[model samples]
Target: MDRIRDLASKKAAVIFTKSSCCMCYSIKQLFYELGASPAVHELDKEARGREMELALRGLGCSPTVPAVFIGGVYVGSATDIISLHVDGSLKQMLINAKAIWF
Candidate 1:
């Protein structure tokens, strides 16, 4: 949990993901398209991957692979992110976080 917090806070935008997860790939692509260079932690490629996955689950990420953090705060999973995008709020959030200037 502490590790997750540390990593999440180190970047303006952070995404916890697994390499093989399609939703993870989509979320990453969306952030890139929005011009936010998000910090992507591929849990499956980490030494402490399992531990981090469990920690993410504890933080309310049900599917967990596409957990997102913006401005050092837990934003939610891919579904939540998509909702924010659809509502035209995701871009604003990135701007506020300084992940994207425009």
Candidate 2:
């Protein structure tokens, strides 16, 4: 409860993924390159994995691997993430998520 809420409230981004998920690997690589240690929740083994899946689905995203959330906002799938990066919005998103900018 509190732990989950705390995790959801962190300034850093959160990426919920399952093992052997290629998109998850890609997103992790990209975020690591950007010097951000995004919190990773492995849905496949998480206690409330199914609840998280339902939540993502309710937010209009697929209940699949690599569901991303930034600053408590759902950011959709891998394609959406890559699109954000390609369009040069990822950094701004990080800044906004962290509430810090240089």
- Model 1, residue 51: distance off in Å is 0.3
Q: Residues 1-102, candidate 2, lDDT per residue (tens digit)?
A: 334445656756888788778888999889888777788888778898777766656667774668777887778789999999999898789887773355
Q: Candidate 1 overall Cα lDDT vs. reference?
A: 0.96
Tell me the lDDT of model 1 at 35.
97
The C-alpha TM-scores of every prediction are 0.98, 0.81
Q: What is the overall TM-score of model 1 with all chains considered together?
A: 0.98
Question: After TM-score superposition, what is the CA distance of residue 34 in candidate 1 from its true location, in Å?
Answer: 0.2
RMSD of each: 0.5, 2.8
Q: What is the C-alpha lDDT of each candidate?
A: 0.96, 0.77
How far residue 12's Cα lies from its native spot in candidate 1, in Å, is: 0.5
Candidate 2, clashing residue pairs?
none
lDDT at residue 41 of model 2 (Cα atoms) = 87
Off by over 4 Å in 2: 1-7, 99-102
lDDT of 1 by residue, 1-90 (tens): 999999999999999999999999999999999999999999999999999999999888888889999999999999999999999999
